[model samples]
Target: MSNLSQLLKESWVLVEERHDDVAAHFYARMFLTDPGLRQLFPVHLDTQRRCLVEALVTAAASIDDPERFTEYVQGLGRAHRKFHVQPSQFAAFHGALLEALRTVGGDRWTIEYDQAWADALGLLTSNMITGLEQDADPAFWHAEVLAHERRGADIAVLTCQPLQHPLRYQAGQYVSVEVPRYQPRLWRTYSIANAPRPDDTVEFHVRAVGAGWVSSALVRRVRPGDLLRIAAPMGTMVLDRESPRDIVCLAGGVGFAPIKALVDELTRFNRSRWVHVYLGARHRDELYDLDELLRLAATYPWLNVVPCCTDDPSWTGEHGEVSEVLARYGPWHEHDFFVSGSAPMVRASLRTLAELEIPADRIRYDSFGDI
Candidate 1:
């Protein structure tokens, strides 16, 4: 790591545990500095605060990897466009961030640390500005919902068509979605559940979390014909077509979205590579898309689908955490792995991959934090 990256990471350790306080301070200072800026965020700042802190931590940790850092920050910058961020507002944000850091750092704060962070933020903001200005795509697209189906009480499958332009995206990428009718300014991210289709429609699988503003609105309230806003897609979990290795995909609950998309894409040309998909949920009822996946498996001899249930004793298939069951099936050290689901599930699966001595480069997942 560069001296600046080292310093930033070291300083971050001091405040990482108290990130909630840091977020509160940062936003308080920013809004206090420019009261009108408060209008730019959602009314409930709980999830937003966590997202801000996670973004900062991710950016700080990535500084040592130039390629990763550039791609992430540029995407972040472009993503921020949906918020209608103004260039003039960056100065206030910068000041507020530094103040939050200094306050949380307490006695450990030093001139060298401050200078390192200043330099880092300068680089970060400059690239973000570059990303914001160079992008020609619109900040967001308007899509009309074409279909909506509830698989269970909380899970919903929805499809939509972009009204003005093609919603071009890779098979495994995700996009932020906004329900203008129910939660206008509050946007949530969801993986596009299918490969790019000929008709320019996209699919999303959403499960409502308790009191989750956007998700509950999507599952319980959204219907066919509703107009929604779709932001530019951003993620790096897409297939590496040139890699000749076999693949392993682990999906838990609705995390199946991107995994399904990848499998859908693979079906078009894959004839040699063996693809294994492990779909896990708490109960048999929650294995919402198993029948469809099984049909795909039957149609494609190279594809294999395994359904796992953690809590269902009556489940006839695998019975354990998906990651644990995955451990029994491999010979996977040579395979490329794609993992998705709740944070705990992803973490456990990653741990399993690590224990199996999987190379870091051979595994990919979206760790951008809760949608």
Candidate 2:
């Protein structure tokens, strides 16, 4: 490992527990330094604070892996384009971040740690700026909502037509969406729920969570003819055609969106591949796409659909959490595992797969709901 990478990891531990306070301090310093930048962020800073901490920790954890870190930073850079981030702002943000670190580290802060963090942050910022400059796609795609169907009380399926420059994305990739109803620049991510269609239209499945701004707007307020701005697709959860292993997909709640897209592509091009999909929900009603999945299973003999429901006494189908269900159907060592859902569900699935002796490299995940 590089001296800089090692120093960052070592220093980060000292302030890791104080992340919330650090994030608050960083934002306060940033907005105080440049009040103009305040409008770029939401009034609510809770999610924003958590996102910053999680992103930094994740990047720190990957410092030992240059290739992985580079990809992550580049993708993040491209995504930040939609926020209208500029080169100069990177330095301003770094300054606030350093102050926050120093404030949190206190007695542990050292010249060596400062220098290491400076070098590391400089490199990461440069990569982000370079990625922004090299990105070929527009910051956002203008799309017109062509249709919307409420799957249940909270979930809605939307079909849109990219007004121009339709995004070219893998079946399992997700796009960040911006709704004008909320704060002007407020954006949230929703998985592209289907494979590319002949009409160049894309689909999204949104489930409104309490107090979720974008989800609420998408599920209830947005309608046909409404215009929505969408960021370029970003994610690494797409299929690896090079691998011939059978597939096992674990989806929870509305997490089935991307999995549905993957299944669509697999059924269309790789009909012979054996696939098992375990869809879980709190109850029967939440399995909104069960009928569609069952329809696909009936048409594709190589595909199997298992719906698992918990917290429902009247339910007669598969019962238990997805990981438990996966455990009961043991010996997943040979399958390529794809997991999408709540953070807890994803974490449990990973742990379960690890306990079953599945290699880490064989598992893929995408946990960002609408970040």
Candidate 3:
């Protein structure tokens, strides 16, 4: 029997050779045939095409055990439900994906070759559908920009409102963000700053990265009343309320976005649970919601807030990167630790926590891939 891994590797070769280029052509075909789908994507076709290609590449490369891969694909399918993506929509994506495949398959593009590709996509999309059903459609999301305040030199908080009776999402969960100017419906995952329920608006605290398309557009151009495109909120960086352990939340810069929401949820029940938050920034001005955090710290005698600054010329507080500050103060054990931040921040803190012999199972993190 041929190994599924070998078959997938072969599929990847065909996919890799011209995945990007094929994706472009496929979307061109899609737009012509289904202008409706075109409306779903950004004005820039190349960019949208890349995201679809990138999503699939990431999906393909993630396959290790076929059983697990099927499960993951199902999860993606379920996740896309909020997009209101139909079975019909998959046809267009499938055509584009396969057309890209044929071009890359070159001499190996035979009958059996075509069949294998078709079977693979069928399995993948089918699993996606199953996953979607399992999660169920909580409710479709409607996007509204509620407030836009320039918090720092380049960072801003843009609060968004969800549809009435919106689907429930956890803290640290992010949605695919779509801005009109960029093409291909770019996916920038922003943590849900507000907890689920009661309030209908999901907030994202965005920081401009100079070259960042979404963040810059949000800080400089986006207005409170303006409407923007967004996908359904979904992510695993959430607090499992059922898990009744003490929680430690650490954030670096905008990583505070998710952690803040999480703390709110923790406070609702574990009013007496030890919830310690260590938030850091380059300067005091860079701190988002400093007053709010301190207030939480004061109110919950068990919850303490430690704000640190690493780069101010007049530096005081816990002076250093957030991770360094964390290891020094925490020999914290038997607690759930959540860290969300820039790649380096998350990586360094994970190392520090491990070196301190914090159990690997207790730590959770949110990290970005590529840019």
Candidate 4:
């Protein structure tokens, strides 16, 4: 237990130290050992590894108690019910995870450390198992894409049809994309851009993050015939199933990707529920998918779409920052909200949420870690 404590603390610090490195290598190691899991991702494994690792590190940093953490970990077991994460796959991931610890930890990872990690891994996986069994399969799941528009240098609105089979996902849940780009091994996160029912191939709202390793690689290098790998679906940041209060959603730039999925799900499931979304962009030129959103708002009687622009020059649309738009729409109480976009955007929105006096139980979001 002492050794386990030491390892847990050290692992936390290590995660803080080289988060991206640890995350990137963690997935690479997993893929190297279990190439069979390769089909479960859409973006490059390297990229996916980093994002997942970072999220893990973030969760670890936020957790305050072993008992609570254990419970929290156990909660994931229920959350993952919709994802269909198999016990066997969880076991395999743990095996690969240990291999990664040894590989990444290198000189410092002794046999004793291995033993400690094995215990920790057992605890973590056990919780996952519990969480995954409760939630029923979502009504929809599948993949399809059709090109919509090519912007500036090279980006396309890959319009997708509904994935008719499988199960549907809540908005905040992001699907793991593992695809063969940048040497046939990449995995990354892409939020379901739009909401679709079961039996719908969800859309991902994406743009070139410019110097990005994966997106840039995809935009510049990858071609039409390539297959994009995606995990069945997983994540903690979905809508609250227990409540039906007024809901507020926040999104920044491309962060809108995941929240959009939630929005659509809300519309379909709680057709009468009041849900609002805030999507942000720097300026008009940087704007994307506005018409579609307006159309959605028009179609959905209970949903409202608020577009916030940093520079709404003509001021035709909502002006000022995203929070201002949030404030204007809300003197809201007991609302469930989701926010997407950059780190700054998340921070700003949190401040907005607090200022609005919204309850702690209502807000939901996924941060891209740009903060």
Q: Pick the TM-score winner.
A: 1
Q: TM-score for every candidate vs. truth? A: 0.97, 0.95, 0.75, 0.67
lDDT at 121, model 3: 75
Measured with C-alpha atoms, the lDDT of residue 187 in candidate 4 is 41
* Candidate 4, superposed: residue stretches over 4 Å from native: 1-49, 59-122, 125-144, 151-155, 160-168, 181-183, 217-226, 269-272, 312-315, 369-371
Instruction: Give the Å error, residue 212, model 4.
Output: 2.8
TM-score of 3: 0.75
lDDT of 3: 0.73
Report how far off residue 308 is in candidate 4 (Å). Answer: 1.7
- Prediction-by-prediction clash tally: 0, 1, 5, 43
For candidate 2, the per-residue lDDT at 35 reads 83
Tens digits of per-residue lDDT, candidate 3, 343-364, equal 7889888998988888977887
Candidate 3 clash pair list:
47-184, 48-184, 74-127, 77-128, 78-132
Flag regions of model 2 displaced more than 4 Å. 1-3, 369-371
Write model 4 residue lDDT over 196-230, tens digit each, in one string: 54445556655666556556654555454444545
The list of candidate 1 runs beyond 4 A from truth reads: 367-371
RMSD of each: 1.2, 1.7, 4.7, 6.1
Clashes of 3: 5
**Candidate 2: tens digits of C-alpha lDDT, residues 43-96:** 788877887887788777777888888888887888888988887888878899
Q: Model 4, 363: alpha-carbon shift in Å?
A: 1.4
Q: Model 2 TM-score? A: 0.95
